[model samples]
Target: MEESLPEALSTERIDGYVDLRSYGAIGDGRTVALIALDGAIDWMPVPSLGSIPVFARLLDGEDGGAIELAPSDPFTVTRRYLPGSNVLETTFTTATGRARITDALVTGVAGRLPWLELARRVDGLEGSVHFRWRVAPGTRFARSSPWVEQTTHGKVIRIDGVTIAVKGSDHGPRGGGPRGLQGSFTTSAESRHLLIVAGTADEPLHLPDAASTDRTIDRTIQNWQLWSSEFSYDGPWADAVQRSALALKLLIYSPTGSIAAAATTSLPESMSGGKNWDYRYAWVRDLAYTVNALIRFGLREETHAAVSWLLTTIKEHGPELHIFYTLDGDTPPEVELLDAPGWRGVGPVAIGNPAKSQLQLGIYGDLFVTMRRYVEAGNLLDAETGRLLASVADRASDAWRQRDSGMWELEELRHYTSSKMGCWMALDSAVALCELGQIPGNSERWKSERDAIRDWIEKHCWSEKRQAWVAWPGAEELDASVLLHAPSGFDRGKRMSTTIDALREELGRGPLLYRYTGAEREEGTFVACAFWMASALACVGRQEEATELLDGLVALGNDVGLYSEMMDADDHSFLGNLPQGLSHLALITAAITIEELSR
Candidate 1:
């Protein structure tokens, strides 16, 4: 996350093309950054999580930009999170000695003002350690050429075209040397070096320097601890779950309380080109899962604020619904491919998302289910919100039959059976709302329509030969999306069990599950799908099996507790986008459901 992602490095471009690999994630909510195991900072979107990238080297190499901090000697590395927090501590033991570098994103703790900071403080714990670091800033998506200037403290890499000043750490006086002043600091007992690479976009933020790089390192720590103080979570994996939850918080854009789909976007779901999508926007489904997980952790404030943001976004944008929107509730994003070499030679590093234009009918399910959960919790949905929900349900019924881009966002259109169920779920919730006296809707009508939709899905979507729901009306390929039946309340009886078993037999890749078969073009384990399996298992009374599977998925997180969109099943390398929102959301949902069921 933000911890490993230096504000300056080519990893930013690398992230854009593929993913920030196995390592760590650190964030202060407004912006999330991805850090890799090789000590690379692959991504950072300054000002806010959804803003244009100031550092996007995950997609490109030197051209894309990044901040790098690595041991100066040959070293073996190990890492862990701070006992009670998500702060990452990595120890490298080289010929010179060993040093522990702690990475944290400054948050509003006690006395600190609001600002985003990535702090990598190196402390020599054993022998002597020498480290080399650099702050390299790229153009907007590395498209803008910037001049590097020798500053009073190290160097200041700037993007004049975009006017972004990526400041470096306090190493020494400027213009020391090309290697940037290297000295072996001896540590028989104690020695320390703190490097801070802060990325800021005042034009986009309008925050003063005092607030931009505000020093509340202690305050940020205290704030996170204090907020986490109320968490009632405790179990064998309590520490792991808590750290995951904290990482989720870091991905949320604080101002709007909206969660981006992942820390880094355009990280190809596929290693090859053409699969990349910008995840810088908020998905109703992903955010809903985030709220569910945080609420389970006793973090009511985040749940409430996030749901409020969702409801507010829906209310503000009437009738026409979008699958994803910006943190501030903008329409379908602007799509463009920045000129840059792709990650590992994967070409066409793109920005914005084409899925924005596609009609993803599944969003209604997310909206209704999330809202209904809030209502079920006895939280009040304001009058305006209730009316908004009713209207959305009404409009959704008409659009249910239309061919959408489908959940996969594939170009070819068909009656995607999974999406049809989503509409049914919306009506189901609409009926629930009618019963609860929350809105004025025809409960009987909604129920009848919901039943009809269910019948059509069963008739056309399920395969007799496969014994599972196919991807669409006529397709023979088994879709992992169909596994959602039990979790979405579509068909949890023998039908769902049949589908789940078939999926396990076919799509279960190694320890985790994949979205579909023969889609190496779509390589990577669906982190969310794996959690969905766990949820379906729990609901189907396979409690023991579900718990075990969930345990395995949690272990997939990197050493410092970060998950990418996919895992390199062969080598177990974390692949796809780093610190994916869907992955965390899955973690949150699976944990909460498991905990609740155990209760």
Candidate 2:
């Protein structure tokens, strides 16, 4: 991965979400664009996925920002992600008939580029429909007035805040060319139209002329189809798996091969008040599972890329490993709240993550889980990587004993049961590496350490009264992450099952599992917990229950198959960040695991 992955918009609740016809998401590996059923860009960020949104009304209505391209009249809408791709097309059916909108962030072949560009095309599908559109740019997290000017080629929106130029296409309206074009036009069933480009790029931007626009769309279709064709797994939920895989890929930052925890952040997990944390960074723990999911789908290249990023992120910063990192494997991003009104008066909409400074030894388990796959696949562990893992093991010997944030990233650090097991995982994988001759380390000491950690977890973390291994030593609460231990090789006995049942009874908000009762505090229900629930169910041989949860989870995707970091249990609205990698990977893992279990 070479640079930051640029992202577009965020999901913000309006006074009422009832009028939204439909919506979809598009992306190049660097950035993503969300399009509404009404043919409006409720949100878009430029250059990199982490960049501030230029059109962010999704979180705050027009006051936030927007780029609208829809019929001026009332219309009903339907939308879907093009099968197996992040390309989303929404069709609005009005009294006159239908108008189709295609949205995509154009990444190069196999998503190997650095810069991001989103392409949107509104083609006339049926009867004539009155169309209106606007592209209003916001500055500095929706706080600036980047200059906009008409050009012969199209329109260029220059950011005084940023050196780059944001270009708009002439394809949308006859007089529209980035100068904020507005007009009423009608199209018949066969009368196709275009709204080619609307994003910022370093180079001279180009809008696809009629012929070229057709080719771009044609190639995009082929790109996704070809990319998705590699999945050979066919099962009851193969379609969903395919979509899940694609969504996962979309969240992956190609330059670094790290998958972000989620796309958009600060959408109320509970409401405007449930904790809303920025989710644009990649967690070492998440990419571990992500690599596995990608490999399961015959996406070895993606797996390798992710491994490379993780390895690189670790190699450069060897003394300590962060729980999370930017997509390009940069040092932990500085967290800051924007100076503007947060979504629906939700104060302090954050931009970066502060937890990066915290110690998270559990990430080593996730790293080993990823690299162990490379070893299993007959790939050689590079010298740097080998030493890095050994050094990590050496460090784990010292650091694993310390109390830091657990998987949930909570404030109070205690002897988290799962964190202890995670230490066991580190040593356990270290022993395996020694046996495989991938790297040479103190296997004997690692084994001893691993066993000690396990013994400690079983004895101290277990709750005889609750009949489950609780959150931490002396803490009576149940932990969802303990459910991750069996897969992490912590414990797979009746104890783990008890924990699962105990969790479902205690923390199950609905069909989905919560991270913990007060983990989010005011946050929405974590979607990743639901996926974790599916996994735990699968582990416990509750195949029927696992399948049921997996099916229920699929229904959580918006009309276009995108997921936010969390979801509102009450209204079922998407909460937290959008297009979360953890959520998608959970879907992928659950889907594949269900298929394997059934087999």
Candidate 3:
């Protein structure tokens, strides 16, 4: 017999800001959730990646919704992912006993289940342990409220046409289950318990049989392990590379084959909190990076899927590509500010990103380079895509001299060195592809424009004072993004080496680096730029320094080998979105560079 208790349970906030590194993430390729060390699911988007978060506690604290499982008594906890997979395992130790919680977003054989399913399995490791579980539903980004409903499937929480059904093996201290699936339960060394929270946007959510969900847990583990095995990279830092590959997989929307820039929104980029922005939408640049990483790992399926999706999306939206788009290939909604106080009291919590309207010249190069890699990987480019590629090359040739936002998406429009470099890369890649007969483009226009871009950059962007390429023409400031161009075949010589040294002297924080030369300190070190610096160092023949920098940057990731967009420069706490795709891509690229240099 089981017992039941009240719907509300007491929860203590873990000290100061719950260090973002302390959270473990799990996803089913559609949506993802962040599980804190205390066993509280603090962040998760329902239905899809771009949807409003159902559990926003990671950003808003107590008033925000959360699904929690923790010992009733004082406990110390430790967590890690199952090797080679995203499934997370956390163990809690108390004065009287200990227990382990295995958490996952269960998947079916086809892919992520059409509905949302978060499964937790608890097994007693020693003595008698008392645990409390609670399912608290909050408004979607505090836009609306969730109400309790008694349905044929039992009791559930309904929010925005979605029904959240919580099913589990144990009840509360009183006999029978709690009315709202909230209660406390006790477990012994011989005991095991299963709990599930499943929902759908419109379908009738049902309470899954516990026995079947147990099987689902095992199958999900197998599925992740199987996917991870298909990736083959025997490179230096193989463990970190594989872990980054797994993290990158979490950003892919399996249903649409689009990759999100990151798993979250509104996590602050700076400690002051004004820098927070949503990163859930798919950016063309991010997808390009994702493809490069996937290809280097010898994983063709995802790369092909992503490239096909990009080509099809461009065909539908015309040859000119937006900076970013929804996972379903539509323009993102207008940016909106949520009413809630942002993470750590940062206000102006935003929903949509306005970057779509910005002219990011770097995307042209990003797309062309990705397609080049796709074709080089022995994949055939369709006729329609070939035309698209040629037209894009022409666009790059015409746009190379124009000033626009660079890769960082800053508001100021100037002759950004990286943007011009990217356009040069665009024409360069197109010329190479045309040489190979993969794209039927007039190589003369591309070659002339490419040469002009190089000459212009060498003359205008170089600074005698900084002894390196500045962020833009006639500026003394350094941008870390220029480091990425070293491997773009522009210059891997003395100038590039001097540029590396300048970036380290100005933007680098040890192994970590800032996006550009700035002292406002509104953001942590940009994770991707650090890795790009490492790769550039290797390209400039500073192999020893490159290896050391790479090792230090890789060590900054959390226990499960996951990285965020930025890290707090003061204490090295992860900031912004978790499992950021660009960060993982940089890691993979740096690892591949080191591996090649070793040979």
What is the TM-score of each predicted model, taking all chains together? 0.89, 0.91, 0.95
| RMSD list, candidates in order | 4.5, 4.8, 4.4
Per-residue lDDT of candidate 1, residues 155-220 (tens digit): 454564333333323343334243222223333336766666555554432122333333545456
- lDDT ranking from best candidate downward: 3, 2, 1
Q: TM-score order of candidates, best first?
A: 3, 2, 1
Please give, for residues 507-597, the per-residue lDDT of candidate 2 as tens digits.
Answer: 8877877787565466667787788778777777788988888888887676556677777666666666677788888787777776776
Indicate which candidate wins on TM-score. Answer: 3
lDDT per model, in order?
Answer: 0.70, 0.70, 0.83
Alpha-carbon error at 371 in model 3, in Å? 0.3
Model 3 lDDT tens row, 1-599? 11111122112464223667767789998999988777988887787777787777877775577888899999877677887788998888899998989999998767778889899999999997899888876676667778777776677877887778888887632222332357777878978898789888767655677788888999999999988888778778998998888988989998889999999888888777677788898899989988988887788888988988888888888767899888888888898988777666765578888787999899999999998888888888877778889998998888887889888888889999999999889888899899988888579989999999999999999988888988998888888899889888787998889989888887777778899988436678989989999999899888999999999998888767889999866667788888799999999999898779768
Root-mean-square deviation of candidate 3: 4.4
In model 2, where do residues sit more than 4 Å from their true spots? 1-23, 107-116, 151-154, 161-179, 201-203, 272-274, 519-521
Q: Name the runs in model 3 displaced over 4 angstroms.
A: 1-17, 172-180
